[model samples]
Target: MKPKRLYYWLMLAVGISGIGGLTYWDFYQVRIAAVTRNQRWVKSVSELLHSEQASMARWIEKFSIESATFRDIANSRRDVAALILIDNRNRQAQRWVRPGLRLEPLDPRVSVLQLRALETQKTTMGPVLIIQAKPYFTVARPLGKNRALIVFLDAARAWGLLREEASLWHIRASIYDFEKNPMFSSFDPVIPAGALAQTLDRARSKETSGIVRLPRRLSWKWLITFHFDPASDWIFLITQHTTWAYAPVIFFVICMAGILLIARIPFMALVGTRREETAQALAQFAGRVDSYIRGRDAMLQDPPSGIKELFPIAATARWLIPQWKRAEAFPRDLALERKLLSLLVESLPEGILFFNAQGGVQLSNELGRVFLSLEQEGREARMVSGVQVPRGFLEPYLEPVFTGAQPNLGKEVDVAWADGKHLYRLWVERVEAEQDKTGGFIVVVRDITFRKQWDYVQEQVLSGITHDLRGPLSAVLGYLDLMKRQLGDGAAAKVLEYLRMAREAGVRLSQMVTDILDVVRFEQGKIDLVIEVIPVVDVFQRIKNTFGVIAEQKKVNLKLAVLGDSNMTASGDRKLLDRVLDNLVGNAVKFTPPEGSITVTVRSENGRVLFDVVDTGRGIPREAQSRIFDKFQQVRPGDRSAGYGLGLAVAKFIIEAHKGEIRVESEVGIGSRFAFWIPIRPPDHRAAGKSDALVNMDPNEVVFPPPAA
Candidate 1:
């Protein structure tokens, strides 16, 4: 046999043998231990029974002495019902019977007890007896010259004591005389008839407690019998059942047998299958390894064999082949990689430059050379050209990157190049060597002159529009209002209502213009927040008053809830905060249909005051939820009456200027909740200055012509 197969067989044999041996040894030890424990229990029960017997004897002796003394007293006074003293002739020697007391002679059972006491010349207690349907037990004591005194004890009381003592041990006990006649028992039914004789026969021979199998074969039961009083030939018997005690051993044996039978089949099959599989895997591995060494990648096309031991070696061989090929042609691969990198760099819109450790230009793309005003030349001339660029321009930016002083190496600096005719955003980065030391620096430059020029033009246009439109829009709204009042309550009352509606529209248009101007001012850093402490409850109440009438007119339930510390205050511009609240609440009321509810909730959270405007209406779509705060972006763009969409955008701006955040959550058919937070104390005024100008641009930049008559 092969060594591997032999080893497998040997291991199987050892395993089976060990399991069988341990099972048998454990079973044997358990059985022995169970038997020893049972024996000890039996001994303990026997000792307890002997102690009970001794106590009974003492009580009997005390009763006998008391009865004897009472007999003497009764002999002096004939008040007792009956008192009799018996002598050796089975006759009463001294007797007293009260008048009208027709006492019978002593019972015939007392003759046997008296005989026993006469024979031993000691006290003797007899088994219980019945006379005239009343139960009794007799106790006899020897007098001098073959005479004895006998007293009958109440049988019920005597048996009750014995039963109470036996119950403490949870055992049922019975007493029998030498002839095996039942003297007293805890229960009426004694041991089964077929087992009684056997139990008695064992007790006679053993002279000590011994377990005897009972006739009932339902479960493991034994009749444990021992002599309680040898001199009186009285025996004690108890029944014991031990099936529960032997259950663990029986279950373990069955389990071991079942496991041995079941395990052998699988183990044998596994041994043969594993050997065949190992051989097949080895053959496959050899073929794959040969293919790999021959530089053919085709070996990887086949699926892996399910052999854990060979997988790592096969994988390593497959991986090493590519590395080996690369190593053989490393110079060619390196040139190709460098050429591809250079092409990629040159194709980028931004300029890229590489500087060596000595601050000399090692490589520069065409854009980089043009941006830095460097001329293409041989290596030495290229270095001289790099020196021509102002040292003050490059050193301040690149020195920190190359010297490792600035761990975050990328920064955008505006550089004026080509004699101040161009502006480039110079991004400087550090390149590290193998040991993380500064190897060199790479600078990326992007021209932003066009972007700066466009921003300047946009600023001028927004300024002119803000200046030109506000005056005329306000005049148009004022004239419309005056015309509405002038045409009041006559046949033109309907026209007056139409005039009012038109004036409200003009007013909204004017407000939109004002919002755009304010947005521009904020973006230009020309607006300052007049920060002050404002009570949140007062704000909630003000919002409630502002929207209450509009909500009633729309038949929508507008409610305000202040949660947790209604007296809370936040630091912000009161007018700005009021504007934010007005915007959010107005939006909520606008979209919400009749009978739909709008709630404005003010709560304190995380050291900030949070405001939430939730509406149960046609909810915003998930796709539009993110852009709802963006200027002029409406959730329902088809509905142009949704009020210009500038409200949420303005609210977001004002909230963030207070160093806060605004977020919206919405699902298509459920509802929408717009939430914003402002801190308890205002942040640095300068921090809010970091607002992006692009975000704050006017969404409706088109200048409308004035309304025609």
Candidate 2:
């Protein structure tokens, strides 16, 4: 026991001592590096400034031309203030100076160096003059017995050159001339009142560094002050804060913490009896699996024995508990969702059935069974994925759906059964399984017998009424025209104006009824397109002729642009295409305010003809753009005077009958642009004969005619 106690004490002592030693070594090396770096910076900046001065001096002594070369050098070198030439023999002085030089009055003491240069006939450097925080150094070079050249160079230029190099080594660096006048510094640090003078005195001595404490703070900083005395007489410095200088303590603390943590292992082991730690570790894992299995949160610790291998299984089980819980609830949630869906389907007006791939009824609503004439005698059965149902009236439709003749998703078709009395519409859609495989088909049935009869009756009534009314309306308009022509010279002005108004009203009513009848015919797919080659230029001319008078009357600008060849002809019905343009442009003219403009543009691209009628007008609202093509849907719904809105519906049908598409884009305050594209190809069977528009056409498609009233 005594031996073990002594061993632990020794380990504690060693650990503490090692931590202290490492701390000392790291700090010592950091201090050494800091000092070396400071010395290098001081020496490098001093040497570079002097070297630049020396080079300038040599250039001055070698240059031949007096003013031009000297002025050139002064102008090029910003550091050079001016170049002066003194002729002792002729007693004439010439100077080349740079502009904007706010140099201070030269120190009288610099004359001593100038005299010495003349006496010795050798180059000499004068005292530095710090003018407005800039160092101006003078170089005196004697040229034979008669001439002396004096050059003034600014050391601030060298600061700009060497400042980047100093930052690469020391962050805070500075320079001063022999007179202790300030020169250049990179960093801004608050210093004591006498810090600079004291630092300069220290730099003058053999010692190159000292410490300066900041005022009102507990921090002291290192000041590295070095100078070139005889050669340049310029002092250089670097400042380092104590925080960065003492960062090594943090590293030492981390190492000590690591050591202390290591010592805790055996200490904890000794707290328990021999093999007691292993038993406790084994104990922590015992309840982990049971707790996790019971769906309780459990923490697992790795066993300190060979049983740790089995520990991962318990850990993985801990991770998998949430997934297991989700899977356990999934079946219950799915059953509830299925029950809800079946109830919703049974309540729907249409009958819906889901069939699996094997021709079995997997799921069917009550309405679906009733539609299929099925009677269930048992209690309400729970629907399953692969349940079977008896074949009945729907079996024939099922065969077509199962075969390749029908697609995965098919259009709804009219079904007439029970000797055509029972009319139904059926749509079949695929319910895809995993990986794009066929799962089943979802069939929807809606009985449309009453709807069909209602529509037929409405069509017959509309036809009779329209046919009966159009003639009287046209005759009223015609007689009004004739009376205006014959009685205009004799009739009162108000009577003539009333006749005109009546004629206009009759024309609008006639146009509305005619458009509605046409829309019905288009919906029944009775109208056919007369496919022919349409001359695009001729079409534009006709548009201009048709709308030019109306647009002029309204004070609206109507322009036409044919962005295709002069002989550009498209394979489409000429009259139908004109109607499309007329409807679009006519609306533009109708809604556009006075002085607003409309553009009718036609272009051919990619084997298709594109048309655009853009207008600066009272634009259609965004919500109305979609519904404008719908029958009787006026852009401005409150304004019933907009010709009953059947014009666009008719235009849409005509465009579709010719195998083309039309769309409208409008903003409330801006304008509207109706654009459409038609395939410019030779008439195919559908275009030349009859289109699917005959049966499947939307009243939302077609073209316009003669600027709809």
- Cα-based lDDT at residue 363, candidate 1: 78
Model 1 clash pairs are: none
Candidate 2: clashing residue pairs, number:
11
Local distance difference test values of all predictions, in order? 0.65, 0.69
Taking the tens digit of each residue's C-alpha lDDT, what string does model 2 give over 1-709? 6555566667878998988898899887876777667766666766776787788767666766444667576766667787777787776777776776653364665556667789998887776666666667788888777777788887667767677876687467666766776667787744555776776777677445544434545344443434444566667666666677677788878877887778766765665654575676556766665665674745544545655566676667667876887899999999999999988888888888887766567788776877556433443433233433335555445444464333322222455456675556665655568997778778888777787688678878988899999888888888888888888588998998898788877877887787778877777777766778888888888988999999999999898877747788888777777888888888889899998888887777766777888888878875465457766678767786576777787887877676666667666778887877777885453533224433343322333211111
List the candidate 1 regions with Cα displacement exceeding 4 Å.
1-463, 484-491, 553-555, 683-709
Predicted structure 1: lDDT: 0.65
TM-scores for every predicted model: 0.39, 0.39
Query: Model 2 Cα displacement at 226 (Å)?
Result: 18
